[model samples]
Each structure stands twice: as structure tokens, then as C-alpha cells.
Target chain A: MCGIAALQLKDPALRPQLGSMMHAMLCEIVDRGPDSAGIAVYDVERFVHAGQSTVTLLDSPSSDEELSAALAAELPSAGAVEVRTLGDTTLVSAAVDTAILTAALRAVAPGARQIGRGTHVANLKGVGNPVDLAETFGLASVSGTQGVSHTRMATESAVTASGSHPFTVDDDLCLVHNGSFSNHATIRRGLRAQGIEFDSENDSEVAARYLAMRLREGDDLTTGLENLRETFDGFYTLVVTTADGLAVLRDPIACKPAIIAETDQWVAVASEYRALVDLPGIETANIFEPEPGEVYTWEF
Target chain B: MGVLNEEVVDLHVSTVRELNSALHKAHDGEHWRVTNPGGAHNVAVGIDSEIDVVIDGHVGYFAAGMHQKGTVTIEGSAGTGLAENMMSGRVHVKGNASQSAGATAHGGLLVIDGTTGARCGISMKGVDIVVGGNVGHMSAFMAQAGRLVICGDAGDSLGDSIYETRIYLKGQARSLGSDCIEKPMREEHLAELAELLAAAGRTESPSEFRRYGSARTLYHFHSENSSAY
Candidate 1:
């Protein structure tokens, strides 16, 4: 079993405590998965700079300085690049068009894989204990308005940084999965024929790419996830996040466990209610499990 | 023995093993109280002797699982597989429960005061499940023998490929699975439903409910039923 925790703050007053709250929630589910952990945070002020794009890269082939210099030289329209390295992943923020910068970075560093690029997302992943991964990355100090974290047990692919979750293929989009996909191989081959390149052999990454492809083709978040429910097979409880929306979906059978608690100030989703027991105002929150094949979406 | 001789284990400081060990060592007619469960999994498992256990708080997965003879009550919600594989006994959950609440239980009385997640009584052998609130999809799938009573609505694909298991619902059903159909609630059925309701401590009238069971047409392979297969 794996663990997935996501929180979307509805009240602006709780923004300052987002990181610490998320860390505490993540720690509660540490037993669900101990092999690797990853987190994606979307903070408007801290990660997102006005008129700029933020990109997260995993398994970068070059050092931070060299990568930043290469990115600057490749995109002449790009302004000063700020880089931060956490484990094998790097976050690079630049004031430029996101699509253009992503394409340029792909060409400049083919070996460097882009996890996500958007206005406010900062994705970090590694292979270790979730609590230590959070401590090493200083996650408690990184504040955000919305966040999604995952602790994986390595059921599908190798336990590598690239295989960890919070797999994002588009700007401001991320997904964390708590169950395995039975038809991933078939879907992977179909997507490959469509000229989509995959960075790892992970099934969850395929799910991320599939959703990204759907969103890129103009399907809304709800429609994209509904299509996922129809096309995918096996038990899954997924939490998908975009720039301003959070969506929770379960498979038709809903074999995996998931609980959602929503209060006036925030909506928190986790593998179990224990992860959310300590959240502020949790005693008064409306807690329930999402029904199978039904999508619950909330927007900021 | 005096009343103070009863066993009381607080899960806040004591582990699940200690509670289970205490229950295993207790004799018949003994009573036990487990406090501060706090949603920890696998509490009071594999009890074979007739006894009484009351959990003060929410419990995690497989609470009172594989129990033989005992009356276990949880004052709060339960996680997945709450009374799975229980041979005989009674388990009561005061709040909602997760998926597979009584999966493959051979014999027992499992009651839930709140709704339950998907597959509430899947593959039930001979247990009786009563849910005060609604149940999720694919409940009682392939159930061999048992009875499932729901006071609220049931989700999609209720009782697919079911066996002799009888289902009583007081509210609407989203859909019925293949080889399963609505059956008439005769006088005997009404009496049985009343008995089950009383056993679960529910006050709903049995007349408002309908019964469902297997069609028994798919017990053997037939060329006309190939599409359903």
C-alpha cells in the first residue's frame, strides 16, 4: 500500500502554516510507504514569480550552476534564472514563456527530465524515508497555498527518484496514486505510439501523462478524470492538482482506501483520516470517503 | 471475583498485541475495555473464546478480524475489513466503516450504525451485516451465503455473481448486478428481517424493505447465457 496526502487551503489566513501542516499530515502516513517520498507544493508568493514560469527537473545530468547557465544561454528571452537543488531534483524559476522555456530546456539538456513547469508548482522527490526526505528538503519551511505529497512502496517500478510520485507532465498539474493500474502496459504502449515520451517505467507516471495529454487537448479537469475512470483498470485513489483546482477520484471498485475531510477553511485528502486528525478545525470538518467512479473537485 | 477484576487495556500506551493477549488469556464471561484505540489497525484479532470487548475510539483496518466467539463494540468508525473472516460472534461499529467491512466472514453479526464504503459484505460466507446508512458499489459481490441489510441506498452493481446470500434494502438501489434480481418478501422473510433489525438495534420497520437474491439460472453453464458469462 502507498500513502497520498493533499490539502487545498480555502482560507488565506491559513497560508502561513501550510508547509508545517502538510509535513505533519505526511508523517502520519509514513507506515504506508517507506521506500520513497515526494511532494509538490504550489505557493503563489514563494514559488511563483509574476510573469514568470517555474520548472522542476528530476535526475538532472548537470550541476545547478551549469544547468542554470545553459538554460539562460538557450533562451535569450529568459531573465535571471534562480536554481535550488533538493536531492536529485532541481527547481528553476525564470521569467519567460513557459512553453518556450520548456522546449528550450528539453533541447539543451535531453538527459534532464522535466517533472512540471508552471507559475507556482515546486515538485521535489527522492528515495528515502518520508520524514527524512521532508527534513532534508526543509519542507516545513517551504510554504504554499496547496500541496500534494506521496509515499510509495515501489509496487510497479524500481525505487528511484524518477520513479517516485507527484508525477507531473504539464504546467501546474500533478498526480499522486495509492493503487496499482492493471492496464498500464496496454495504455503505455498506446501513448508511446502517439509519440509521447516517458521518462520512467512507472505506471503512475503513465497516468500523469495520460491526464496531461487529455488536458492539453482541451478537456477540462473533470472530463479528463472521468475519461481516466473509463479507460483505466484496477484499484486506484488519485488526487490530481492543477493551478487552482484539486480533484479526487477513485476507481470503480475503490479497493484502495481514501478519506476526505473538508472544513470551511480547507479541504484535505489522505489515505486515512489519521493523517488529517491533527489539522486545524478537523473536529468540525465534514469527513467522508469519495464514492467509486465519482470525482470530487474543488477550486480556489 | 469482584467487578474490579475485569481487564482494561488502554491502547494509548499498550500495543495491539497486549490487548489481544489479554483477550486470549481471559476466560468465558470475562469483560474487557480497550481505550484510546485512535484508529490503530489490527486490534483484538483472533479471539476464539466467548467474551466482551468494548473499544472506546476509532479503529483501523481489520478490527476484530477472524474472531470466533466474542461481542466487540467500537464506539467510533472502523477502517477496511473490520470483521473479515470472522467465524462467529458479534461486532458493532457505532460509526461509518471503510471497504470490505465483513469480507468472507463465515458466521457473525456485524452491525454498523453509519455508512460503509465499497464491497461492504463481499464474498460473505454466513455472516449477517446490517448498515444503518448507505453502502457503496459492488457490495455483496459473489457472496456465498449470508444476509445483508441496508437502511439506506446502495451504490452501483449490487450483488454481482452472487450465491444464496439474501439482501434487504429499505431504500432505492442504483442498479443490480448480473444474475441477481428482486425477490418477493414473503411472511418468513419479513419475520427474518424483523429479527435482524432488532438484533442490530435498528428501529426501521421491515415492511418498507425489499429483498434481493440470486436468480439461480446461472448455476450451470448454458449457451444462451454466454453473453452474461
Candidate 2:
């Protein structure tokens, strides 16, 4: 069992409270996923800066200053490398190409695994009690236009930073899942045959990779998930967020819980309504669980 | 005996366990109001006393589950397993309900004023369920005995592998499950449907509904139908 929460603010007025709102949601679902936590933020100013690429990775043994100096020497064209650390995740930013930055990141911080890369997103992951990790990361202080957080119970993976959800394998994309996939092993073999490498043994990573592949192939968010429903077999309630949108989907059987609440200002989806009760304007929001095998998306 | 002075308990202030513990020992004819439920779980469950309860907001899983001899009125929506395994009494939700609204309920009347998710009355044994809105897929699956009245539509596989239960549907079903066939509604069925509708405070005419029940083909084991299982 896992808990998933996501919010996409339609009105910029509510963006300032994005972190506080999501933190409240995390607190409500801490009982569901006490093993670990991960979050992906889509704000430009508070987490990741605009007009530059940011690469998120697991914490490195090397200090940010040392990594910055190594990165500066590696790429002369990329100017003024900056670093930010939150809990067990670190963000490295530069004005260079994301691919080159990621390649340079591997040489400088060999121990760090790049989990996410984008100009508008920052993925932070840690292994601990999810609520405590959120506190350690200072989630309540960050501001964002959209974000997704996950608390995990570790059904199919070990309790490690790499095994967490919000598998942001692709740039400007994030995916979090709440149930296990019975046929993930078979699907993983197929994707591996196509030269798509994976970072961990978690089943949710396979889904994230599959979605990224589909999105890269020009399938819109809704069609990509429909393809996932046909190919993968098992129970899942998932939330996928992009630079400009957020999407929620449940497997056809849909036994796993999910509720969605929408207002003029924001649209939020969670594993349960408890995660959304403290949100502003929730009492007046249009709330309902999505139908089985249906994809619900919101664009900011 | 619990104190009679506790007439109202705010869930944000008191715990769901405290309310349930108080309800377990409640005196007959006692009334209580719960405020700010905030989508908590297991509210007002397992009570055997004839007490009245009103929850002011949405609830999480298993609200009024395994219930008996109590009336739970929820003013907002409910999460999964709403009123599951109920033994007796009445549970009402003024808003929509999540999956398995009344699974494996042995007795009682469950009233959902809005749409219900999948498996609305799976494995029911004698409880009566009235849904004012649509019911999702696989509703009444393997139902042994009961009556399910849906004033709105039903999703796919309605009443699959059902037994002895009667379903009165006012709207269309996407598809019927194995061995669940629509049957002609008799005068007695109309009388019972009308009674259930009235009990759930619905004003729909009973004549607009169609009755469905088990074909009993799965009752006797047959090798020819083994694949259908």
C-alpha cells in the first residue's frame, strides 16, 4: 500500500501556498506510507530556476561546492553552476544542455544517480518516515505551481532513496503509483529489449519509463495511459504530472482508492479524501472518484 | 455506562476510536452529532445500541462497518468499504460513496444518495441496499441473498455469479454477468421495491424498474460451464 497526492494550481494566486497545502496532504496520508517519501516540485523560483536546466540526483559524497567546481571545469560554456540540497536529494543547475550536464554530473559525483532533469521540475527523494522527511526537506516552505508527493510502504522494493516513487525518469515529467503490477517483469523485459535502461528494481519505475517512452513518441498524456492500461496488468492508482499538466488514472479493477477534487483555483488528487480536507475551497470543490480505466487531466 | 452528557463530539478534537467506544455502550434513544469528520476512517462502527448519529462531513474507509442497531447519517461523501459487512440497522450517505459500498453485508439497509463505485453489494446476505445514483461495475457480484435497488444506471458485469438476490434497476446495465438474467417483475417485487425506495427516501416509481436474479445455472456444478467460472 502507498499514498499519492498531487496538486496543480490553476490560479497563480494559490501557488504561494503549494508547499504548505501539499505538506498538509502528506500529513494526512503519513499513516498509509510510513516507509519513505518523494516529491517533485514544478515551481521556477522556489525550487528550480527558470531558463536553465536542473539535474536532480541522490545525495553525493562530494560537497556541492566541489561538484560545482568540477562541473565548471568540465563545461566552460555552461556558466555559474549552482546547487541546492534537500534531505537526501540534491539539485544541480547550469545554463548548459541537460544531456551534457547529466554526462558531466556522472564524472564529478560518481555515487550520485541522476533521477530527474528539467528546467521546471525538481524531484527530491529520501528513505525514512515520509512526514519526517518532508520536515527535513522543508517542504512547507517551498512554493510551486504544481507538485506531486508520494509516501511508500515498500511492497515490491527495498526502503531506499532510489526505490521511492515520483520516478522522474524523463525531463519535466513525474509519475507516482500506489499499487503493484503483476506483469511488470514481463513488460520490463520488453522495454529493456528496446534499449531503455532502468535505474532500480521497483515496478513503478517501469511504468514511468513506459510513459516517458510513449510521451516521447508523441502520444498525448491520455493516450499514453490508455496504452499502459492495455499493456500492464495489476491494480494501480497513479498520478502523472508534466510541466504544464497533471493526470490521474486508476486500473480497470480500481480497488485501490483515489479521489479528485477540483475548484476554480486548483485540482487535487489523492489516495483518499483525508489528504484533501485541509485544502482551501475544498468544501466547494467538485469532488469525485474517476471511473475505472478513465484518465483525468488538468492543464495549468 | 457511558456518560449521557456527550451529545456532540468533534472528530478534529476527539478521535474516531473515542466516538466508537462511546457508541458501543450507548443507551437506547441517545442522539449524537459528529462535526469535522475530515474524511477519517471507521467512524461509528460496530455499535449494537439503538442510537442516532450524524456525521457532518466526508469519511474515509469503512464508515459504519460491521454495524448493528445504529443509524449513521453522513452529510458528505464516503470512501471505500462504506458500510461494509453490516449486520443490522441503517446507514445513510447523503453524498457519493466509493467502492464496495456494502460488501458482504449480512443485514441492514444501506442508502447511498449519490453514485457508488464498483462492487456496491458484493456477497450480500439479506441486507437491503438502495442507491439513488449510478452503481459502478461488478455490483452485486456473488450476492447470496438481498435486494439492490438502483434508481440510476449500472456498470458492466452487474450481479455476476449471483445467488438468490433480487436486483431492481431503473436504468440500463452495460452488461450482465454470468448467470444473471433479467426476469419479469411480479406484483410482490413492485411492492418490495416501493417499500425500499420509500425507506431510502426516493420518489421514483417502482414500475420503471426491471428485475434481475440468478439463473441458477451455476448452482449445480457442470463441467460444460467450467470455463465460465
Quote the lDDT for A108 in model 1.
74
Candidate 2 Cα errors over 4 Å, as ranges: B1-6, B226-229
> Model 1 Cα RMSD, Å?
2.7
What TM-score does the first chain of candidate 2 have?
Answer: 0.98
lDDT of 1 by residue, A164-227 (tens): 8899888889999999998999999999999998888888988999999999999999999999
| Docking class for candidate 2 | high
Candidate 2 per-residue lDDT, tens place, B1-229, comes to 2336549989878989998898887898888888999999999889898988888899999999998897999999999999899999999999999999999999999999999999999999999999999999999999999999999999999999999999999999999999999999999999999999999999999999999999998898889877988
Clashes of each: 0, 0
Worst 10 residues of 2 chain B by lDDT: B1-10
**Candidate 1 — which residues are off by over 4 angstroms?**
A44-50, A75-77, B1-7, B222-229
| Candidate with best lDDT | 2
Best by DockQ: 2
Residues A1-300, model 2: lDDT tens digits? 899999999999888898899999999988899888898889747567777889998967677888888899988888899987877888899998778888899888878888888889988899888888888778888778999999999889799989988999888899999999999999999999999998898999999999999999999999999999999999999999999999999999887889899999999999999999999999899998888899988887
DockQ of all candidates, in order? 0.50, 0.87
